[model samples]
Target chain A: MSELISGSEILMQSLLKEGVDTIFGYPGGAITPVFDALYDFQDRFNYILTRHEQGATHAAQGYARVSGKPGICLVTSGPGATNAITGIGDAMMDSTPLIVIAGQVQAELLGTDAFQEIDLVGITQPISKWAYQIRRPEDITWAVARAFYIASTGRPGPVVLDFAKNAQIGKAEFYYKKCEFTRGYIPYPEISTKQIESAAQLINDAKKPLALVGQGVILGNAENELKSFLEKADIPAASTLLGLSAMPTNFRLNKGFLGMHGNVGPNMKTNECDVLIAIGMRFDDRVTGNLKTYAKQAKIIHLDIDPSELNKNVKVDAKVLGDAKVSLKLLTDAIQNAKHGEWIDSFKEHEEKEFEKVIKKEVFPENGPIKMGEVINLISEASNNEAILVTDVGQNQIMAARYFKYSKTRSIVTSGGLGTMGFGIPAAIGAKVAAPDRKVCLFVGDGGFQMTMQELGTILQEQIGVKIIILNNNYLGMVRQWQELFFRKRYSSSVMINPNFGAIADAYKIKNQEVKDRKDLKKAIDEMFSDDKPYMLIVETEKEGMVYPMTPAGDTVTHILLGDE
Target chain B: MENENMTLYTVSVFSENRVGLLNQISIIFTRRRLNIETLSVSPSALKGIHKFTITTFSDADTIEKVVKQIDKRVDIIKAFYNTDEDLVYQEIALYKIATDQLIKLGSIEEMIRTYNIRILEMNETCVVLEKTGHYEETQALFSELSQKVNVLQFIRSGRVAINKSKIERLSDMLANLNSRKPEGYVEDDEYAGY
Candidate 1:
């Protein structure tokens, strides 16, 4: 017979059974019972108390993205649950696995508009992979195990569990068990061998076959398999922003990034390839500019885990549904070795021209304020291409994607789909927590940094060793760039009279430095990385600096502009 | 062509009977800016589970995404989208007419035979009639009755549908789930009350 235990104890036991080592959360009135229960389990799992529920959620996302495990978060009801909505939406869009447990008002007080009462399960339904409200004490263990299973399966996403106050305090007979199967929920779809064989036949027949890789490669841990497939077939590959680290930057077949502000060759040559093999990417509009003209001539092969993604965007000649590693291995075994040397060299020629016209001036500027690109380049060099780079949205994100060369998978974490602004610092904290031995670096813009700057308190409290570099452009750089190019530089509300970030770091008891000169860029980065503690470096850059090679909205990828027109 | 191309899709969702599952399904429609023409919820053949039938006007692409989103909900066992021609559907409607108007016109008997509506109840003040058919057929009867008799009230239940396929999808899914169940976990029949 099983012994009886409180719902709070059951919650703690379920987490321990799942092997959770850390959880990020905030305390509140309704959640006090669970917090008290956590006090006894402090030796079992380390809890990092964040200042805001949003920060805790983002921190959880960061940890999930780095470790490929379900990140756990807790918060109170009403305002606390509402605060975590953005982070939940971000995780859903980016396919990050997270388990968020929220404390609700007592069972009897529910729907009575009691204090700290809200319909968290209903509110989070559209955004979460699953959302449930636990009513009975016996359901706590079942709910927790189910939540983790749903969060970490298939296309991973966030799941919310709302615990009624009474349920937490109530007692029930407990037997901790892991949920292995969910009715009607198929986590992994069966891979069809016929589809794999057809995909191989198409790849073998193409003269100019190009591989478009996305975050699926990293999620599947299929980086080595993808590398082998690309080399065996002699196919050049380009990465979507989130797929940055799937292949090392130094790989010969790596054609660099592809998108609005990506490399010259990848964007321009997308239309030129005869066959386009998309692995684990949904072909969102940003990656495929103006779908009417995007790779219309290419015979497309889409490989993704989600069956719904097939034929949703660009129609493909063949569709392979399964994990990237499994699908890639099948394709590699069936494919014949062939050389596309001429097609690969054609991309290099375009890269040479872009390097002469744009890359040279941006990375090795001689006389001006420190350019954002140069700072990213210096940091990339100083970090030895090993640090996990977490970047915020807007211009800073694009520059980091452009300049930083990652040599490891799961090395770049950023807000790709939702493009949330204040995602850098909190997510960096989560990444550092997930990978304590590896160095974690953050690149955030002035506009985005201010959105969640309160997380500096969490950094101070936990003493998390994340090196943060804020690119102080004194304006919303991406919006300003759009205004300059598209709206004739009206610059409406983009400019900012920002505060002293260094001083803010000081107030939080974190070490800080400010560098405005180009000569001091390397020295500042070296100093920041040399320290064993948390440090924030503010690098002031030219306010008018813009990310170039942008394909204007609704335009073809071939019509990319190298600079402001 | 654009107006004609906009199709009406019927989405059927099977889920466990949870308190807020209906509100969650409605929210998905609201987010997509699709209006719900009709929504019906009832218990399924399987115990402890419910089924929701929702109708919306959208193209194939939008309906596909909506079905995918609905399937993402934890309680939802499965969601299927079908066109009007793919399903056998009907709605029950009730119409109340003033008895004096029918008596004065002397066409109540003839109208009942022509429209295939049954007289549910009759009194001096009013006569209640019931009809079972597609929405358009019911609306036609209402229009015909209005000209002949003074119509007092009209109401229609939402659509209930069954796919033309021989086997029920829910039974197949449940069987699959049963086969994959781990040890010590009970089936839906043994699920404790919420």
Candidate 2:
């Protein structure tokens, strides 16, 4: 025993036990003791002092997102703790694993007008996966351990630990033994065997079956299982934004992304499918243009980890709630090979006919501005078929989904639920941090890049080599496109007078290049890829460019407008 | 230095009974130093609660730190400025003036109306007048009417001092240290290492 230690020490000890190497935090009166204790452990743990509490939280988010480790941030009481709300909400919406520690006024002083006191647990309750306040020092070890487990396991998200000031100073005997989490709250609802059987039945009987993969597939690492099912059943697949890179986009039956901004092949086929095996996706509103008419005739088979999500949106003929990997394995085992030759023929014919419907205009002038496709394609080529592409949410996110290819699960990180701007660059920095040697390219929109422009400092400071490809459209093209399609072109507050990204990179002493034409895209990327310092490529494109084939909001998926048609 | 230019300061406010008054006062002060010394509230005989005092050692220049914070709290009806020697002030005690004695001096009616003193009770022999205000103001009103009526015993509160303006002890200490001959400055705490 290392003598009796305070709850704050136990919290730090639990982090060490979990092999957490670093944390970000700011100090204040209520949390001073924790920082004081941390002083002695500085050699064992790296603590990054942030300029602001929110900065610490976002940095932790960046660390966790890329490292595949639970990110941790510490903040002092009252306003300091409240400052982390935005970052916590970001983590919650993106389903990233993060741990937040906030110091509270002493238990005796709680609800009293004590100095620097705030009700942090109640404030953070709605935005966190779970929030707990430790009034006793003895509960620190278990609470910290449980926080890690809850944050990293299942569908990951942020968990908060609100520690009272006294708990940090009070001493108690500490142990490092790991204990099993009480099963009562674990919620091990078994996957329905009948539903699995029904899923198999649907897979065997249907023609033109499409597998719509989402983030859950990556969370479950169901790529191999998914591929096996797809190959055995000859089913084509389309990925959601979060699901991008869950399956190799280069595969023969990959339809790419399927939604408003997705590929023509996936969107058209999604409407034409007879059986849709919607695996690991929650059928977000973005994916289902008009819920009533989306996959109108297709019988749906939904598989997810959270049972509550099943039939919460579109009613399914079969709903399997277990880990997607396990569920897919079981469902595949139950299926026998059956050929839907007529369905396959119809899908291929429809794909070709729709492919012909595209206007096929060479929008990029021969030597003029760089097209978004050309940049994405060059990055794909330079990647040598092995790099992970992380995308920010915007038109770039959509373009990457349509064009970028992935070879493994969780190879890409993108904001799906929150559609938060500034997520891409930091998340890319995070991905690079997680997979140091792998080439990681961040696809960001000009609008989204500005949200986290400061993280470029961290990139230079840490010397993390991440290739940033900024699509300079000068507007929030996604929302603007929505405005054009449905909101009567009232594009308010969507346009951006973006700064010169190359200049910004130069200010950070980062190597950068500007791509003006499709012809220069490949050469620019190749030249930048050879150097090690952080590089940014700004591709200036048309100002009012709109993502096509947009399904108007609240309208049927089938009610899509073809720009030329 | 402690009396004229302290690094920290606290001040107390006595006000009419009302809701959400403390919040308004504290927010203004907290927004400044984000520090509070100590605050106490209790009932006084003048039909309102008596605020004890703040013992902040800060100088007059930074006194706005306290005043601005107090303004945001809802309960405080008004704030007053005080120097250490201006009046003998104590936050404790209640004083009552009687009407029968004022009639003898022939000054009771004018003083009572001007101060808006309430008549708490009446009998054949005496009537009690209740007046609530700051200790100094109450005392002033008490003295002006003292010759006219039989003076009753008055209660007094503890010492709560506000420093004169433009003196800050901590800033002076830092300035003094900086102006001294060159010496290696080693931080006393781990945080100062930054």
> Which candidate wins on TM-score?
1
DockQ of each candidate's interface versus the true one? 0.56, 0.01
Proportion of native contacts kept per candidate: 0.60, 0.00
Best by lDDT: 1
Model 1: DockQ vs. true structure: 0.56
Report how far residue A304 has shifted in candidate 1, in Å.
1.0
lDDT of each residue in A356-467, candidate 2, tens digit only: 4432321323554555655676687788757777788877886676566677656767767777677777667666766778888889999888877887877777787988
lDDT of 1 by residue, A207-249 (tens): 9999999998988889999999999999999999999999999
Q: Candidate 1 chain B: minimum summed lDDT over ten consecutive residues — where?
A: B185-194
The C-alpha TM-scores of every prediction are 0.96, 0.70
Give the C-alpha miss distance for residue B71 in model 2, angstroms. 46
